[model samples]
Target: MVVLTKRELEQIALPAVQLAAPPLALVPEVDLSAVEASDAARSAAARAVAKACEDHGFFKVTGHGVPAPLLARLDAAAAAFFALPQRDKDKAAAGAGGGSPPFGYASKRIGDNGDLGWVEYLLLGVTAAGAAAAPVALSEGAESSCFRDVLDEHIAAVRRMTCTVLELMAQGLGLDDEGVFSRLVLDRDSDSLLRVNHYPARPEAAGEPAEVRRRLTGFGEHTDPQIISVLRSNDAAGLEMSLRDGTWVSVPSDTRSFFVNVGDALQVLTNGRFRSVRHRVVVSSARPRVSVIFFGGPPPRQRLAPLPGLVDREGGRRRYRDFTWREYKTSAYRTKLADNRLCYFETTATS
Candidate 1:
């Protein structure tokens, strides 16, 4: 990974200037209940998804059919795990499933680059077995067993939802193969991942109000490098997305729903028709914030390019040059979080 200069890191960590949040209803919301409905209703739902992808690249989903109790269990498990002492968490890191850089627990530091944030997270790779083996459940003890069980069940449900939306995306594009996108994520060698983030509350109890203090960067700005991201969070909200005009707006916190966003890979696959929404999390509240994201990625060896159907051949050549998923993933890992990672792979003439 390219190391960032201290100056660049400082620039990235500068306090975020927050704008007033737009109305909640302004963000597009799609009801996935249509997925199981009549063909006409499904078609309408698909159209809605397509329009949202083109216009905002960020939206919410309702009637997604995920079990409420299961989500609650995972939330409770996450809370308990975060509440553990620093030493305990550090010890649990050993069981975080070894890797080159290692997949375990991380705090403050966002990446190999000098990027920093007021956040701590557990990064775990999801496998063909359908789950991520993270720090919490290493032993066969009851507590450990319960944590792994709930985490696994939660991922299974969220993974299904993620695939459903991917299929919807294909349908929205009027593709004959609705599974075109979903199949990549469902592949046995898919490089999916789960990231559990915890942004602790400000240490100040009796100080200036939240508004008086400058906003702290929880997670700096960036677009996910996968195909799609399904996010679940508690009531606390600090999420923000960059509008097409480069304006940043607060995302309304919805505890009962899931927020889905397009990623860089998806943008490439669609020939840049769908945006890869740039987003960040800012610390504006004193309450601790917890969020878990399921990133749906394809197999490393999978070749990535503009889908022939999505590319308007009559108009011109593809927007992005052909490359394997592994190539893109490697390039992403070697860049700063806020960099336009896709710029390296785009066709100069097309851009």
Candidate 2:
């Protein structure tokens, strides 16, 4: 129900660089073929990576070892999945009203009022069942069986990397590594949505109004509220991140490297020590953009708020009240997204 008034938000130009440049570290590509030879090298790389995660909400990871051929297969499979006829694709579509989690496809307008997100998607969850069966499910009913296997492998690889990133983020925030990992990591019923988006080339404009052009976006502007997100895309780059000063930056894809960004959940959990940023993907008339986004959330039952340890020590004011992830999800479903400020505050607690 809460939507921000147009006056509340400025419709500004996208920036050439992310408004807030993430602490970026370039990780060299590690050949998976020479795993044994690179053991010590990989461990050192991991430590360096952990440091970067602690310092910046975003980073570029390379050399951990995923192949370019595998990346190509994922790209092809994603394209193939979206290429299916509407009727066939509809089988996996979110029900009439949409809003269900994982294991389904969503239409362009699914995010309410036909917001026209840049692409369609297949949701993924981290439940025990999903973990055990996602590979089989995605592979079995698809038009191509091989694609599913490849996609599964990719997901598994990314999940491992995500864990490493999250763990490092926790350590960087000075939290007990195990506790942070146990608390913030996605769990059963926690949705790890994978949006496979394909932006079709819009028809050439015949002197259309520029305002109309703005509406023809692959994805609109907004910040992810999840703790972490991992993105992979082909050569067609349309993704942009807004910096704190409101400059936008292009995050291009390098071989074997996927773009990782922080989300709101981490910001709240770490009491603003980390950050989630505003971003969008624009579609083009000449060529379409394809991207895969994995939005990772905690299990529904988990409580989310600023960690007490991170609160201001003077008078011990807690900026955010404790709320359950399930409740937040419900609130999101009921509200007009992006219309309101994301921060929430509670009465200061005196202990």
| TM-score for each candidate, following the candidate numbering | 0.91, 0.74
Q: Model 2: residues >4 Å from true position, as ranges?
A: 1-56, 94-103, 129-142, 205-215, 312-315, 345-351
Error of 1 at 271 (Å): 0.3
Give one digit per residue, the lDDT tens place, for model 1 in 228-283.
Answer: 99998998888888889887788988988999999999999998989899999876
Cα lDDT for residue 279, candidate 2: 72
Candidate 2 lDDT, 156-242, residue by residue in tens: 677666766666455545565534753455465565656667776544534655444432445677777677888878777567666
Q: Please name the candidate that would achieve the greatest TM-score relative to the true structure.
A: 1
- Candidate 2 versus truth, CA RMSD in Å, comes to 6.8
The pairs that clash in candidate 1 are none
lDDT (Cα atoms) of all candidates against the true structure: 0.81, 0.58
Q: After superposition, how far is residue 147 of candidate 2 from its true place, in Å?
A: 3.4
